[model samples]
Target: MRFLPRIVTFFLLLPSYAWTQTMHNKRYNVLLICVDDLMPELGCYGNSIVKSPYIDSLAARSAVFTKHYVTVPTCGASRYSLLRSTLPRTKAALGNEAAKILSDPETAIGNEPETFIEQYRRNGYHTVGIGKISHSPDGYRYPYAGPKSDQRELPRSWDEVSFNPGKWGHGWNAFFAYADGESRITMQGEVPPYEAADVPDEGYPDGLTAALAVDKLKMLARQEKPFFMGVGFFKPHLPFNAPQQYWDLYDAGHLPLTAVPNIPANINLASLHNSAEFNQYRLGEESAALDQPLSDGYARKLIHGYYACISYVDAQVGKVLQALEETGLADRTVVVLWSDHGWHLGDYRVWGKHTLFDRALRSVLMIKTPAMSRCKVVNRITSTIDIGPTLLELCDLPPLSQADGRSLIPLLNDVQDKAWADVAYSYYNHGISMVTPQFRLTRYFRKEQPVIELYDHATDPLETRNIAERSPDIIRQLTPLWERGNTGVYAK
Candidate 1:
């Protein structure tokens, strides 16, 4: 009788063992779309004013993370955490040049991988990078060299780093390019803050990028090996230039301005900064100030520019996603849309990122796996550090040993997974912030008064005021959580 039971168990395990082998061998493609300076103010996110139809369509069939945050508010540092799946441990790890280690000739790619893309490359996947995958547009260090320079930002990660500059001479020029074939750099601070060029989509670099991605999808579809394609869109970031048609989609006068325009009360000036990044446009009609808010007219106009750029990007994104479907790769591909970090669109009297506030740290995160049948809202707090492991798991690739983030497969399976932790950590402006459902606690490293701050999301979701002084008991409860995040910021 015992032998008969053992034989039955062996027969039952055969099907499951074959299924496991198939899962490991399955070739699932990845389409990673990285947008710069995009906030969660999309139509899908319940924003009434924005017109993001293409992204909203993707969100309809995807897992939209409502509380997705980045490890840093800046571009490169946040992307560093996403690519490495590791938290920032040193001051250099928190800077924009953090990923330069992957491209620097002196640095060696040893036994460990520097990025998830590299890991994917190792496991028989063809990786292609387009547009601004790294801090440098076109994945090259063109800012310090000529257009024809050969310097690379992520040299070994991608099989190829390519882009189309359109009318602009090079990638960097295309990034800051205007319709007149001149860029912000070439114009030397003489250009205005925004433009509604009367030209086709090809007039902007992102348009060219979308076209290139579409063409690449056709090529990748014919290849045997699975591929990982990263399409980084650079728009709605600075100079907010888009086609006039997109700008016409909104009435600037009726569009809503930011809530809580001034810096939050009870916070020191050291915790905030003057709008230096926004003021870089010397010819802009109005300069942003910390002491006062921008004029209503200017603020509305700027918001209009931002919205127009978003619509423009939305159309470009539609073209790429459509190409995926046309190529017949949509069924087997895992598509992910994420932003490097959120931008301060006149929120907190600041016009850019680099703050630990919610607006600056939170951005768009949408994932559409082939197995998911309908849209699901993931309400738990997730971080950029979790993206790499999630992608690897979705693709059934071996996990990277050095990643600090946990796979979000459980949340993806069950949107309201009770076993999941609901906290996300962010670092910026010499501060480490812990984000939960009801509160945000921050501890600053600088020698300023009121170095610790807390915001109650239930009453003041906009973070209009700091209640750390009045809520002593809450601070005591959140301090341990804040310290737990602090440990990740510093290496032992």
Candidate 2:
């Protein structure tokens, strides 16, 4: 009314429109929690021995994916696949693709003009990451809008805390410094005398991770802006350390035996390049004597240690969930819990991850959305790649053009009759594994030589027998499916 200048009037109208746009584009906050080298040992997954109270409760509120599988078994490869929503084989073929895509200003993975995090950021959400969200060390490459720091090491990225004492590297009571051909194990921390409170599960790094996550969540909730926080826990991996109390929970004598008596003679030497990594954890005569056969007692002890570690990690998970609820972000936030890949605790006579075995490839995927009516469990074969697209959908962001995975919103919403494919594909250095609802087929191709392994999971859930040599017709039928690299025809 006061005859304001035209430019001034335009500027005056801009703020209201911007405010409206911000409100209109508000996206759901995401809390992505990842664990390293964890298997499906939680109570929700039907593991009676492992005590995962927090995850079990979280599963009660979320849609638990019973048949979720990682695209790769290794840490670096699996993390890359999940973050990019690309098949592991595709990523492997495009070696260094992750670095290339992230560095490209024009087409960053998950930062394209319409990428999920970019869209959320544009809509005024704060994106922050903690711990090992990226394949790179020190949380190097993520869309973190805030401080980034490696709490574990120097040359920190953004912001970091100090490492928790007595809880590093799987919480092993003994510390080993790798030097020359010989390794020495010395007691780094005191194992409390057989007391009720001195369990190994209580002393693991996962507990530290959980405490840090809880603290971070509390701090973040004070800010007005909604946030996407990634909290990663490193545990149940190696060094097999837990509180002595956890060790006391199970008698080594009563622990389960290894599935195999010894390493299979049929496994080629080339397939065992990283054998030392697994060998480092073997106990008793095999570990002490190096080349000697593993004793039954030592194998049982290793298994017992592994179960204790899982329970320890599970307790840490409970702490984070409690923090989320306490901070009042539980209702508005979308919570996604995943493991990079499964681990092998004496399955197939292999002691670590890196193979295409089901014990190493299958992981846990649990998604809790604010929109879901109740807890549901989907047993369909799903790949880790689907996680990226699912997060995009949850944030109300358009799927990235380069994303090979389809959104799993339909599945979460109880649309069971929707058509989908049976096969979920994974890959390693030179091996390819294709898993269907009832079968797992692995094909190894190296130097033009072909080797095949197949397991009917329905009949042999432990994968103790290989039926590939006996079933040529089944192999022929499934080989093409693996070659196609498509789960099934779905809308892009």
Where does model 2 exceed 4 Å of error? Answer: 1-26, 89-119, 141-204, 260-274, 280-285, 288-293, 372-374, 447-450, 486-492
Write model 2 residue lDDT over 125-149, tens digit each, in one string.
7766565665533344322221333
Model 2 TM: 0.76
Clashes of 1: 0
Clash pairs detected, candidate 1: none
lDDT, candidate 2, at 190:
22
Query: TM-score for every candidate vs. truth?
Result: 0.93, 0.76
**Residue 292 displacement in candidate 1 (angstroms):** 1.0
Per-residue accuracy of model 1 over 381-404 as CA lDDT, tens digit each:
999999999889877888889888
Error of 1 at 293 (Å): 0.9
Clashes of 2: 15
Query: Candidate 1 — which residues are off by over 4 angstroms?
Result: 1-24, 105-109, 144-148, 487-492
Instruction: Give the C-alpha lDDT of model 1.
Output: 0.83
